[model samples]
Target: MKTFIYKKYSPRPNILHLYEHVVSIHIHEQLRKMGYYCYVDYAIKAQTHDQGLATITIEVYNSMLETEWSDLLLWNFEITDALIQIAYYQFLAEEGVLFTVKNANLKEELEVEHSNGWQTTKNIDTPKDISGKDDTALVASSKDIPLLSYDIVLNFQKKEVAKESYHDALLTLGHNIQVHLSNKKGYYRSEFSVIGNEIKLSFQVIELLSNTLGQSDSLIATGVIEELIESEALDVFIDAKKARQLNAISISTFVA
Candidate 1:
């Protein structure tokens, strides 16, 4: 079992109440229905409401992968995507109904094999402003294996701070993330690519997490605490692991 943490102090203290387990659980159930499995462990410190500090731990696993490890790292992109949406709701609740928040873009491309052995691709359209994006249903069809590509965009307002924090966090954590599907090696060859804002966001998140919380602390800081306890994404992963015996799908099919 792997653990993820994100610890950050919000400039606006008013949002403190929003970080509670209740809200996290609410979000978890919503995602669970969407096919995510979730579990949350948290503690509240301090006697006063405003002075209290909250720390949460999230553990995730995908039963489909047939491993004791959790896919939360991969699902991070998807759950963060949903968290951004929920944040909008919080934004609205704080503001009035007339106010609007700009949306982020989360473009995704998925590769699948048709029953006839032909490769098929699908593109999903989401809000122009989205935080994290990943392919959710890759192994659904027995005819085709699942090769997924994820893309995520940082909120323009949070770009500078976010980038710094993301990079710092990656350095502190002593961890590396490799999108193997895009690598041109071995049995898998892929046309998939990661550049521009998508790459930028990954770095930014790492830096932000590092600056706010040390390595492991940062993972807990990034609302990941909320994600683990309140995500159905884990449930889906568990189901997927049981359903598909295959390891990750091959990317070589798309090469020209």
Candidate 2:
């Protein structure tokens, strides 16, 4: 259904990529073995940028009616949507993955129901089902929302600035860094983390900010960098500048 779960913002594009592989390849494989077919892919078209606004989606190949499906998949009227995503939200909040979450909070009540493998708890004599990350359970969670959530929930809301300004700051970052971010694409984080309190906060020149964000997509990806610097989050990758070279716009799109 191309269900866009979140308009996530963050700085680590590469980390995000690895996460997608885990879900689409590692976790989804288990589901595939069970006979239920589904599709999972995040940051659909990154197009090489350091910062990005990636799009994450999960689609089920099943078009069967609810009556035809097991009670586990019959969640909130969705066949496979909730089944695949709930575990991920739990992971991010618990794992400290360094990103923020939004929207799904709109469906806040959608938190995990049974922690013990989603749990085998049942009493009223409804159709029996066990949910968790195990293969034996008929009602199991996809258990990959950190990737899905990471891909979809960039959490740009953490910025004190408005989203438009955040994007504008990124455009400036692109021009200065000499990289480009397609307006429709997701912005990713840098290769390093800024969470350590005493660590030398020098921005890791992962790609050598050749333009000085110069390291290709590393700087241009102003997606969802969870770290902050001097109250200006964009500085986490490269310093903010006017992006003044008029012709530079051809190489990288920016208004400053």
Candidate 3:
């Protein structure tokens, strides 16, 4: 079982928060129909437009399956595409409001801007369970979609005590970031709230990697993993550009 929630805060004198409210409602409905359990519980701090805040709680309960959980995450990533479509024609939708599904690569971009370095790569392999079902097959059979790999890149501004420290930091950052992208929580302010801040990350998952990259899997999976202990077959990145280059495929194996 996973419990997800989001809190939105805006200074006084901003009516834009209302737009965030509407987007939240829109997401809630879509998530529920997708088969994962979801709902919204809000915490409002003020009555006026200028200084208001909203927080929504979304939770998912899973039993004995990791693939379903991962598929739920893929659904969350697609929600951004859904928002872009919704904000275009909704009566109350505001202009210049954009939201992006945050991913590991997004964090790498920010770290680069801030003089910190980071890298990311995606590896789509069939990790199997005792039952012998690969993640892709499992997700597809359940939701009629496929599953892919998602990994992160981390660069340091200053030499730290060890690479392990940076690795640990990236791991925590990954968990916190994945929550919002997956729509595990409510709307964070307009989509722009996500697209525009260091508080958020930038990453892209396309429906078709091959169509966009014009490269085959055999050609791209060069030098993907460096460690002997790592078992996620098909290293997706050989370096920075290599790691960031990936197609965001819809995953169905992750929903419970």
Candidate 4:
């Protein structure tokens, strides 16, 4: 279990709301497609068990390649790597959608990985009104995966010989060029190879008891609160092996 936290100053003077949400991403699903297929059974999940704070947890059930070192040392790093990819590729620059990992386990887990690899601002002050939905899906190129190489193919062709409408013809095809077109007086056989990523995102709502709300105090906020109060939705980016940066949240307090 882990906790995540984000805060928003309310219209009420001296009153603020700390938002909470727990998200889970199926990291292996995308990693497997990237040929990152190594790991036993395990799980990654984020939680906001406490108000104003969130935590990321990675639990490995087993592994095939057990080295002399602690199994967690290597496996945890593997998970962190995926988490970083998820953060940069999908959630960078999302205004007001900032939070942090509120657990020591994640810190200890990071010792095996990178230090402070997953960090975000403490609060968000976006537009007075916003829109969003509670959906999570794959992002092409992860919308941010650094290009590895050519992922598109384009070509051009011209007709040769009077009968075939082509007086002269030449064709070339290689690793980059897949086809050559030679037809009509002139023609173009060009297209791009998109380096698509099937990385997907999902959302989860944190339901905190509202009866404890105080006038001059702050409490854990939920999507429902944001939607009802701000008329906007929020997408929080988090990192856990199963870390999920909840997708567009519902557009009202009931849904937020």
Name the best candidate (by TM-score).
3
TM-score of each: 0.21, 0.21, 0.22, 0.20
Candidate 3: lDDT of 79? 24
Worst 10 residues of 3 by lDDT: 191-200
- Model 1 stretches astray by more than 4 angstroms: 11-14, 19-23, 38-54, 63-256
Q: At residue 33, what lDDT does model 3 achieve? A: 43
Give the per-residue lDDT digits (tens) of candidate 4, residues 152-225.
22222221223211111111011111111101001111232211111111122112212211211111112212
Per-residue lDDT tens digits for candidate 2, residues 121-231, read 212122222212221211223342222211111112233444454454444333222111211122222222212111111121211112423233333333212111223
The alpha-carbon deviation from the true structure for residue 228 of candidate 1, after best TM-score superposition, in angstroms, is 18
Which ranges of candidate 4 are over 4 A from the true structure?
Answer: 1-40, 47-52, 63-86, 92-256
Clashes per model (N, Cα, C within 3 A): 52, 40, 22, 26
Model 3 Cα displacement at 151 (Å)?
Answer: 49
Error of 1 at 147 (Å): 51
Q: Pick the lDDT winner.
A: 3
For all candidates in order, the CA lDDT equals 0.26, 0.27, 0.27, 0.23
For residues 1-256, write the lDDT of model 3, one tens digit per residue. 4444443333311222333433444444444344332211111121112223333443443342223433232123322434533322221222222323233332232222223111111322222222222212102112222222222222223322344433333332233333233232221222211111012222232222213221222122111112101321112112333223322221111111
Can you tell me which runs of candidate 3 are displaced by over 4 Å?
12-16, 37-51, 64-256
The lDDT, on a scale of 0 to 1, for candidate 1 is 0.26
